[model samples]
Each structure stands twice: as structure tokens, then as C-alpha cells.
Target: MSGEDARALPVEDARSIAGVPDGFGRFWTPYRMAYIHGEGKPRDASDAQCPFCAAPGKGDEDGLIVHRGRTCFVLMNLFPYNSGHLLVCPYRHVSDYTELTCEERVELGELTATAMRVERETAHPDGFNLGMNQGAIAGAGIAAHLHQHVVPRWGGDANFLPIIAQTKAIPELLEDARARLAAAWPAEGMEK
Candidate 1:
């Protein structure tokens, strides 16, 4: 069928035909299926099964860690809303923000701020989205771990893709973003 002719057909008719152009974009991200299926999600709330508990054990590059602090660490979000998306997590295996010690709370805040600064220096986002999901009911993917999300934003970054297709298009590779942010991270006494 001609492209114009296909467009004129009822939407259901166009999508039903094999080898026919349906006028919808395809991202072909099979990798997202792992996330959809909960491949790496912790089986339980135990520290033994937690990714946040294990990340600090690996080298910085392998772990995609941006910086390590006394009480907390910064790392790139595996499933990012945008390039340079980061999470600030404490080494302790505690759930809920209320469980954080005074020192942990202070360092988590500091690390989250530093994550924003590094993202601005590296990707130059127009602004940021920063928060912590307290529980699974509150949208925390790993409800057993306490972490704060620091998501960088640019003007017009949102579109119909996520709402319509359940997909997000990230422009930069995770490794590349981790490297850039890690390099741009300010030293302990040098943070601005």
C-alpha cells in the first residue's frame, strides 16, 4: 500500500497488516525488558540481595560510581530519566529516610548537591528534579534501600514518548555519563 493510503486507513487496520508501515516509531530497546521483568530487583529487603549494598564493593568504573564519601556515595541511575541521572545512597543497608543517622543525612544531602553541580558542569542541564521515594508504594523501585534521586532536566525534555510508549530516550551512554560526572566531581574540601 502507498504510504499516504496507509495513513488514511483506520488505525487498527494499519497495525494489523504484516510488513506494513504503521506510522509509529520504534525504539527497539530489548534491554528495557530486563528492567520491565525486574531482572536485577532485590528478591527481598535483605542487604545480601540489595544492589545499593553491593555497589560500593566494586571498583568505581565497574560500579558506575561517581564519588565515595564517608557516609554516602553517588552513582548513575541504571535506568535514567535523562543522561547524568544520579542517586545518592548510604553504605548502610537501611530503608526509609527516617532510618538515616544524623551523619548519613548530612552526607546524603551534600552528595546530592554535589551530584547536581557535577551534572551542571558536565551536561549543563537547565534545572534538576531531586527527591527520594520513601517506599514501594511511593514509587521506590528498590523500596528496601534508602536513596535520593538527582535528575537533571533541560527545557522541553519531556514529550509523549514515556506516557504513550512506556519508553525514554537517553542521549548518552551510562558509562560515558558516569565517567564524566566522576571526573567532574569536586574533591571533599573543594566542593562549591
Candidate 2:
């Protein structure tokens, strides 16, 4: 969407443009998978049913499970950048990185490595942009739970949409990314 178009668009469009998770949208927080109820209490550091919580059930065919372990897992970005934008997150709900337990920290590190390796193998981008937007100030979409982002990047990935309009045009259907990654990646340590 163009900047002018973005400005003229609705708030829902803006959040969608920015990749914020709604009841039907995707967010990478290690907490609630997706909103269970739009009216239910917004979401807190304590909620665990977030999309990342359980083994994806019936309706989650498009929910890609890249790597799953007891404490951590890697998933394809339901919304993506290149081909293999992914998310690395602990299974538990954690708001602060400083509050992470030794176990969670270990899982976070290991899962991050696994996510990077798998994403690279799949996308083969020139570089990787790995980060965590801690809270609103840090541009966190899901502020309750902390998760690391693994975005694969090529030289020309940055487009004119944001340059001209301050809007991010992520043009691929999330289901497609999930299908491709889920087909290629075997979920590891998931049985536990």
C-alpha cells in the first residue's frame, strides 16, 4: 500500500500493514498463539494459549511448525518477508529477557540457532535480521511475551512502499509460507 493509500486506509489496515496480530492475524510472541476471544481479557504475560502454546490442532494446517521442543519452538512467519521469515520463541510466557530462567534461556539460544540454520537453508538470503521488540517502545506487537524474530533478507528486499508511504507491503499469503516451510522442515524434539 502506498503512503497516501496507507494514510487513507482504515485503522485495521494500518495494523495489518504494520504486521500487528489481531484475533485472526499473526504475532510471534511465545505467549498466546492467536487471540482465543477478541473480548477476553486482552492478553497478559501469564496467558499461555497464544498461538505458540499448544500443538497446532485442526484449523492450524497453515500453522507451520519448523522446530518444536519442550521449552522452545521455531515457526514460519505467518506473515513473511522473503520466503522464510521465521520466529523463535520459548513456550512459556515471559515478558522480560532479564527474567528468563536458565532453562528458558538455553532453549531460546538453541532454538534461535536452529531457526537461523533452517531459515537460511530454506531462504538462502544474503543476510539475517534477528531481533526482539521488547515492548511498545521497542515496537513489540505482542508485548506480553518476548520472542526473537528471524527475518531472512536479500539485497533488494526493501521496497518503495515504505520509502514513499511509510507502509510495509508484505505481499505473500501467510498460508503459502507455512506450507512451504512445513513441507521442508521436520519438527524436531516435538514429541516431548
Best by TM-score: 1
Worst 10 residues of 2 by lDDT: 26-35
TM-score of each model, paired residue for residue: 0.87, 0.65
Q: Evaluate all candidate structures by whole-model CA lDDT and list the values in order.
A: 0.86, 0.64
Tens digit per residue, CA lDDT, model 1, 34-139: 7788777776668486888889999999998999999999988899998888999999988888899999999998888888878888889999999899888899
Using alpha carbons, what is the TM-score of model 2?
A: 0.65
Per-residue alpha-carbon lDDT of model 2 for 114-184, expressed as tens digits?
66665566667788888988875887666776778888788888987556644355555556666665566
| Candidate 2 regions with alpha-carbon error over 4 angstroms | 1-43, 47-51, 54-62, 186-192
Report the alpha-carbon TM-score of model 1 versus the true structure. 0.87
Runs of candidate 1 with Cα error greater than 4 angstroms are: 1-20
Q: Which clashing pairs does model 2 show?
A: 3-165, 32-50, 32-51, 33-50, 33-51, 33-52, 34-51
